[model samples]
Target: MALIEYRFDNLRHDRIGSRGIDLQSLDRRSMEQAIAELRALASQKDITFPRLPEAPVEPIIARAAADRKDFSDLLVIGIGGSSLGARALLSSCTPGNPGCRVHVLENVDAHEFERIWSGLDPERTCVNVISKSGGTVETMANFLTVRQRLLDRFGVQGVRDRVRVTTDPESGILRAFAQEEGLVTLDVPPGVGGRFSVLSAVGLYPLAMAGLDVEALLAGAAAARDAALAPEAESNPAICFAAHQVALHDAGTRGLVFMPYATRLFDTALWFVQLWAESLGKVRRHADGHTENVGPTPIAALGANDQHSQLQLFMEGPADKCVLLLDVEERRDLRVPAVPAVLAGLQHLEGQSLDDIRAAELRGVRAALTEAGRPNATLSLKDTGARSMGALLMFLQCATGLAGSLLGVSSYDQPGVELAKRFAHGLLGHSDHAHLRAAADRAGQGKALTSVH
Candidate 1:
């Protein structure tokens, strides 16, 4: 595959000036060293990635694409990684192709559920309930609500066939329920986490249902894995990225934002956010066991959309943020001018093609962000397809792990999220009003909340 070259040198000075960081003399040598170490680790971990079966999954994917079932809609019930990865893949791949609608329900917002329920025909919709643990409160709740809706609309038989599950093997409430209820099932690998599961069945199944090329996607990921596992700093994209980002963080840049130019990539940014945050946000302890808070804060923004909204804050706000700009190199649909005579007078503007206009706009945005002193990096995709997307996802995941290692954090575990889960369970399982009252009191004290009392 041809490597997408970056014009980093052109933007480097402007980025440094904007962020007030002199990265000119930053040790690129250390980055090279870190890359070497990470490459070795990646090579050693064979168990990290298992070969996906070629036969059964391929047939299922084909069948799903062919059998448009009565379901005009699909509601994916999952939280965090389970939801974000698949949502990102689906959104980016299906721009303007509105054969069927895909909605993701990850939160317990009643209003959102109500809206979805009102719009969807339960008989005509398939609900993909995804939970690695099978007992995630938010996911299970959404599943139950949707299941009930199905029961009400299409009766028992419809519910049995329409509801599908993606989860671990022979464990969790979801797995058991899927078996007992005889719903269609997909196995989520035990070793994979939700954020790191885009190339797995968790993401592939949905993308397949949406008529995406899962084979191309997996091939892309495999290619990326090869590139990331290579030792050379100049050759290994993931390592180079990791080194550069870690060096930036050490230089006092703490805020990281992913800004994708296309609207489809907005959800991709969210998926990246979870992967970066869950991996890097940690308190590193010294040899003496003393710990310190040190991690990059991750944020996501849509390109032209946020260019109008949040670009102001990014440009004028604190000078501690690093931005990653994702640019798609090819667009399938191009809007052309009906006639060259539409815009006359201005010599430069007259007879300008739509593609020319779009190019100019994108260039202008990059130039503006660079001039504003934002340290921005760009990732260009040759085209938006399953292969390129899969490559991108795998590349980001490897880069994230390397970046975390450089920052001295365990990039695999998420202990903080477990705390929230525990607290939520306590509140839900117990009949004690004290805990609820305490939460309410805290909420009331916060200025953001509207208090009844």
Candidate 2:
């Protein structure tokens, strides 16, 4: 069996509840009705259910990887979905491998700009300035700052050659600027939101630069898409997984803790948190027009590290939390150590090798979590490669969408973010709302704002 199938089989046997739900119990007529409703809801508005790209993105990624593009580092400038997904992919594929670093500048902190500038060599660095709209203040501000820095370090000629753009084709200012300057460009497809653009070229370029196998990644994603679309409940892993999570939430577990064993996946957890929180968070109105809060609270934790910190709260605090553990079958390329003479007489300790100790530790953690009845699920990646990471990304996206549907919320829209954006713009003197600006000025006046409480 392929590695993907084996890992999935292990998940099925070890994680899924054997008898909690059966499709047959719903009656064929009722099952059809539920599916029809789900399909209709998924298709409504600009929401497009996940689908495999008609032309594979692998070859394109491979070409990018093989190109003679000489750049020391690729500076990705964007916020939220524009930057998070690509950062997750790059971090996972090369956990500790030291190559050209993929530095993502998502925030407008001046200190971050100073740090990036300190490390970057303008002559060798390539900048990928990404924004769906030409008008995101944070992104545009960062772009201008970085461009000026590059021009100062090198001449105008160098700035023009090193800067690239990824944005909407015809409408955005960035797109127009790239065209005028003759800089290389990637098109961000219209109608696809930033959160949903990971599988698109937005993520492909960075993954290629990180030396991941893009083809294998796409294949795994394609397999996952197929499974999500399957009719059979047993064959469809995404549907089964989503149904279980929904059942758990309805039964009173509304908080989700994403715990990944490897430190590199910490950023991936953040991305998932945004996807789940933003997508499902909404004020839903009933037949009588009554509204209610209907989204899960998401938290991210790194394993081994969090095993010391937050595990206590999770284990004893409330029974209303569900944990998802992302465990890898093997780390990229670390070898087992040889036995030493630190301990003399423990039965297995004297002769056991390092691999034995590592394996034992992994087994102990899984067994302990399972015994605690924490309602935990594990995603086992065969190895941290391009394909495995790609498959994982697609799997989580589909699972989250299904979970949202089960909870009766739209998983693609994020209307709550607008309020914060409006507030921030007013604070920055970009909005016409005078009251908001006045409030922001008063809030910024206090010494407490600069000090840690």
Candidate 3:
């Protein structure tokens, strides 16, 4: 099988003639150092992401198989890393799986909260609440809301029967609650953080239970991890991807433009946005004792669609964007049948397929961007199937890991997010954050707006 191909032809200054980096001759010692750092992180006793591609699938399968009889719908409850990967997967792949739809509750917005609450029957729905820390405020809020729905319908006994949790193995409030209630619990490995936990039970259990091929997905990721580990810098796509992104960032490119040519892969871009933004966007630098803020903003756009809306700005607005184009060889296609002789003006579309048209549009934009001297790269997939999707995810994950290493930032931790969580809890009357709430009240007391009524 042809693995996804990443070509940097459009990213070279020789091709763009000015805006790009000469990654071909640049010293790779730094790249090697970054990889070494990544290896060091993997070697540390506390991390699990490096070995995630090879994570066992049997346990996940068994859990899914066992839960299939009682739950028709899988309701994933969590925010950010907890739900993004699973959402992306089910969004992109579940159309082909002969299984019940997966509903994800990632926010506390009234509409979203009530929509999911109303759709699921507590008796038939399996609620998988995933939170690595088990105390993420938004996740906990959703879990409580959903738990009550179950309680109201099936009472305490049925609530335990339909509920499961994927969280820290030994600690956290969720852990304590699960153990106390005798809920089926799956461990969210200590080493694997939420964003990187897809290969673990956090993602696998729901997918496998939904009747999708978890092994094939893992196999694809394993292949990608192996490919990324290739010692040769030029041949390792992960290394190259990291290098290009770093070089561009250092060269003053402020935005990472991910515009895929396919519509189905849009959520993949959203998933990448979270992975890229949350992981690489950092302040503390381990390499040099760090800058307070540094990270490329990730922008998502869909081809043929965004071409009309965002292409103008990208082409003429600023030279601070690096475009990454992606397109898959269409797995299925529909022909534009010959038009009636009475409608002769539309003959140009006759006999042409939508896939053919889309592919051409994809090529056209790549050429247009090149001609515009826009630094870019293209990730071409042979097909938009699980294997290639798995490879793409793993490739990007490896790239993100190395890119953070190069930037000297902590890729796995989100120290800044903790402040907001604390402030939010304080506002909500949580005793632990009471002091923060007091501080917030003091801070906001004098800031009320004065306006003419």
Q: TM-scores across all candidates? A: 0.85, 0.83, 0.93
lDDT-superior candidate, 1 or 2: 1
TM-score of structure candidate 1: 0.85
Give per-residue CA lDDT, model 3, range 238-305, as digits (tens).
98998899889888898999988888888888988989998988885445654567788899999989
Clash count, candidate 2: 1
- Which segments of model 2 are wrong by more than 4 Å? 1-49, 55-68, 94-100, 180-182, 331-363, 433-435, 439-453
Model 1, poorest ten-residue lDDT window? Answer: 47-56
lDDT of 2 at 199: 74
Tell me the spans in candidate 1 whose CA falls farther than 4 Å from its real position: 1-7, 10-56, 59-71, 94-100, 153-157, 331-347, 353-355, 430-453
lDDT of each: 0.73, 0.68, 0.82
